[model samples]
Target: MLLTDTHTHQYYETDPIKREELMQRCLDNGISRLFLPNVDSASIELVMSQVKVYPQYCFAMLGLHPCDVKENWQDELNTINAAIPQHKIYAIGEIGIDLYWDKTTLDNQVKAFKTQINWAKKLKLPIVIHCRDAFEEVYKVLLEEQDEDLRGIFHCFTGTLEQAQKVIELGFYLGIGGVVTYKNSGLDKIVQQIDLKHIVLETDSPYLTPVPYRGKKNESSYLLYVAEKVADLHQTSVENVAAITTENSKIVFGV
Candidate 1:
């Protein structure tokens, strides 16, 4: 029962003992692969350090997050690009537009998102998007840039069924996370209708913990809860959910 956590911040634990414990917990639960998305320039070292320690389990992505877009976004991009010196990047991601926190930076976020989208295409890598309260904006950028070379996952997706179908049409996958397990989130209805081929699972940990563990700090091991919820929605077994979504994650990351 090998499960894949396609998005998580496992490097944030900091403490060596806690970090090892977290890794072990993931292994114990049969989750051997974890994709770490770049949050910003500051997280580059932390993420790479974890990748260094667990090269077999942790994969990395590169990009500026929407919330991190500020006046000096160009400099941040340069820093992220510089880190590509010799490292393997699974995707150009956790990047996209987010209007929930600060609508003031919407323009900068869009600009950054486009820049990263182009970067992903140029590198022939998939992108992991972080869309929040701005699906239309993200969709517009994707529409303008959609091409044979364009492909990626809409990470932490919490959108409408129409949007999900559109994303599939755009050659991307919907990354389902803890929100699907929330009561009345309505994501279960969509999950039931959406085929497993276009769906992937993510933890986005240290955040978005599932119902039983909601309001608590999330971890990669808790990814099982989200998988269980997906199984319930699909009326299948947790093992089946793990097998199918792990395959979907591999399809996106090509690992």
Candidate 2:
């Protein structure tokens, strides 16, 4: 069974030995395709380096993460934009409103979100969103910017069923991550109610690690845990989850 991690930061590990080990673990676990999203100007190189080594396994997405929307946010965007044409990118994201970290940057976050959304539209590429504690704020911008070309996945989606439905209505897929495996995250219940077609699996690795390995550093191989949990929730098998979600990833990333 081929599995896909629609969002991951596995490239953060620069050590050649550690990186190879990580990639091997993913392959051993049947996780073959991993889409890497860079958060800022600095991470673009890190994302590309992984793609360079494993062109067949890793794909790249460029964007200015909401948290990085500081005083020099525009300069960051300029750098990322300039890098876009130099390398092939499947999406424009990991971008959206993140009010949890700093509420003061709400204005800048919205501006950056809109700017990146426009970038995706112009390029005719999907966008991978990173919304946190700002559903209403993010959704408002999506509504304003909704169009035939505005499509992508809502990365790390841990919102309510209502929010999930709203996102689906916008022609975007829900990026289900390790949170779905948490006993009390309530994401499993929400996911159970949503059709698998509207969902895609992700680890957001080195971040939201799944249960049985929660509280530890996450990696792409752990995507099996997420796939297993999703299969259980959907009353299916891991192979089935792998197939459906991987296919969904193809639909989004066009690979």
Candidate 3:
């Protein structure tokens, strides 16, 4: 089964020696593509290094994460904007409003989110969103900015069935991860309700490790666990899940 991890931060591993080791492990496990999303200025070089080291297996996206927005958010955006013409970014992403950590930054977060969305539209690239405790805010922004040109993935989606359907209606894909394996997460119901075409598998590693590896540091190889769970929930085979989601990711990233 050829699987694609739509999201992972293996690049954040400062240890070069160990980073390559785990990345090779991903390749061995049939993870043909790994998409890395930029977190902030500090993470640019680190994440870009993954694409440099393994050009075939790794791809990147450029954008300022919502949590990283601050008083100096504009400066941060300027720095990333300058790098745009120089690098091949798959999408504008890991960007959206994150109100879970600090509600006070909502205004700045919204500004940053819209700014990046504009950049994506101008570049004709899809976006990869990172939303937390701000679905209403996210939906509002998406409604305003969405057009036939606007498309992307809603990474780490853990919303209700209604929200899942709404995202599909808006022409977006839902990124499912380890949270689906959690008991009582209630995401299985959402999964059953949504078609496999609108769903994609992700690890969000080194976070959201699936069961049997829960609470442990996640890796791209762990994406198989998520695929397995998704297959089980949809009453399908693992191979079928992998094939379909891989194609879905290709559509989202335009790879």
Candidate 4:
């Protein structure tokens, strides 16, 4: 089976010596596809450059991250828009409310999210949302903007069954990642109850590495561990889990 890591940040090549090696390892381990989500204006060039280096294996998503929202959020969105034509952005992504870190920027985060949502609607593209400790807040905005044309993935989804049902109702898929493998993670329970059709697999690599490698730096190669956990939760085979989740990803991102 060709495992696809629907979300990862292979672009963060801070360590040159390790970057190429890790990518090769991922390839050898069957982690063939990667979708890189852009944070903001400053890293667009870097992210796109990384995508260019491995065009066939890596895909890109363009959007202003919730944390990147600030006083000049509009200018940053403008910057992302200006460069969209140069590359094929699979989705408008990694965008949503993040109240866990800084509450002071809540207003700006909401504004930026809504603005990007509008852009996704106008462009006829799916979205990749990064919501952290702001479920109700994110749901509020999503409900207001959601329509038949709006579709996306709730990247790194860590919510209850009710929330999952709500997002599915809004025509969005849940992005299940490394967090589900954690011994105490509530996501395992959530996934066991929800159907696989509403889910997609991701690593959020260089971040949420699964168990066995938890607390260590994550890589796209570790996506298999996440998939294994999901398969176990659903009491299904890994190949079935991968096939269904990969199809769910293509449905949302139109990849």
Candidate 5:
């Protein structure tokens, strides 16, 4: 069973000496591919470099994260726009509202999110959403700005069943991650009702590490933990989870 980690910052702080070792560990554990989501202009080069180093195993997505939204948001978007043709980006992602951290730039975040959505539509690429504590706000913008041709995954989705349905109705797959393995997480409840084909696997590493690895650094190798937890939730096998989610990923990422 070849598993795909559709969303992970494997390139985040990736060191030359340990990069191969870390990625090999993931490969050995069934993770055949890892997609790195861009955060801003600052991290694009590092992400691009990592993709070059392991072109066969690594794929990169370009976008300015909502948290990075600020006064020069347009300038940041311009950088992402220019980078699009340079790299074969898998998607435009890790982009959307992040009201959990800061609200000072809420308006700017919406504008940036909408603008980026337009770019994604124009480029004919899927998107990876990063909604947090702003589902309603995110939904509002998605309803208003998302083009009919646009589609993708909602990364790190921890919302209610209703919210999941809403995203699904909008034509996005739920990006299940480490949060699914949490003891008190309600994601498992909502996920039990959703079709496996509408789900995709992710790590969002080096963050949201699953149980047993919670409070520790996350990696692509730990994706098995999340897959196992989801399988258990669905009363299925890890291989089944991997197969279905990998297929779901291919639909969204085309890779």
Candidate 6:
């Protein structure tokens, strides 16, 4: 079974030895493909370094994360925009409205979101969104910007069935992460109700670690546990889950 982690920050581990161990664990668990999304200008190098080491296993994406939309947000975008052409990127993201951390940056977050959406359109690439407690606000911008060219995954999606349908209608896939494994996350119900074609898998590693390891740090290797949980929810085999979700990742990343 070949598993894919559509969204992960495994590159954040700067220690070379630990990084290799992390990659080895992922490979051993059949988690072969990992897409890394950089949050700001500072993380660009880290993302690329991981991609460089495991070029065949890792993919890179660029964007300004909503939570990082501070006063110098413009400069951050400028740097990321300039860096885009220098490397090949599968998507422009981990970008979207994040009102959970600070509602005050909503305006800038929206503006940054739209800007990155345009970037994805222009580049003819998909986007990977990071919506947090601001689905309505993010959905509004997506509606305004909806078109044939706008397509991507709603990363870390934990919304209702209606919201999931809305996103699918817009030609975007729902990115299911470790949250689905949570006993009370409610995501498993929504995921079980939805078809696998409109869904993708992710770990958001170093963050939303899956069950049996929820309280500890997350890694791409743990994606196997998530695949198992999803398989259980959908009443399918882990191999089937891995196949469908990996194919979905290929569809989105075009890799």
Per the 3 Å backbone cut-off, how many clashing residue pairs does candidate 2 have?
A: 0
Across 1-255, the per-residue lDDT of candidate 1 in tens digits comes to 999999999889989999999999999988899999978999998889999999999999988999999989989998998886568889998999999999999988988899888888888899999999999999999999999889999998888999999999998999999999988899888889999889889999999998898999999998988988899888999999999999988888889
TM-score of 6: 0.99
Count backbone overlaps in model 6: 0
Among residues 3 or more apart in sequence or in different chains, the pairs in candidate 4 whose N, CA or C atoms overlap within 3 Å are: none
Q: Which pairs clash in the backbone of model 1?
A: none
Is 1 or 2 the stronger prediction by lDDT?
2
lDDT of 6 by residue, 1-255 (tens): 899999999999989999999999999999999999999999999999999999999999999999899999999999999999999999998899999889999989999999999999999999999899998998999999998899999999999999999999999999998999999999999999999888889999999999989999999999999999989989999999999999999999999
lDDT agreement with native, every candidate: 0.91, 0.96, 0.91, 0.88, 0.91, 0.94
Q: Tell me which of candidates 2 and 4 scores higher on lDDT.
A: 2
Off by over 4 Å in 6: none
Q: How does residue 83 of candidate 4 score in lDDT?
A: 83
Using lDDT as the measure, which candidate wins? 2
Q: Which residue pairs in candidate 6 collide? A: none
For each candidate in turn, the TM-score is 0.98, 0.99, 0.98, 0.96, 0.98, 0.99
Per-residue lDDT of 25 in model 4: 89
Stretches of candidate 3 exceeding 4 Å from the true structure? none
User: What is the overall TM-score of model 1 with all chains considered together?
Assistant: 0.98
Regions of model 2 farther than 4 Å from truth = none
Model 4 spans > 4 angstroms off: 14-17
The residue-by-residue lDDT of candidate 5 on 159-204, one tens digit each, is: 9999999999999999999999887888889888888988999999
True lDDT of residue 236, candidate 1? 93
- Name the lDDT value of residue 240 in candidate 2: 93
Predicted candidate 2 versus true structure: per-residue lDDT over 59-123, tens digit per residue: 99999999999999999999999999999999998899988989999998999999999999999
Looking at candidate 2, what is the lDDT of residue 52? 98
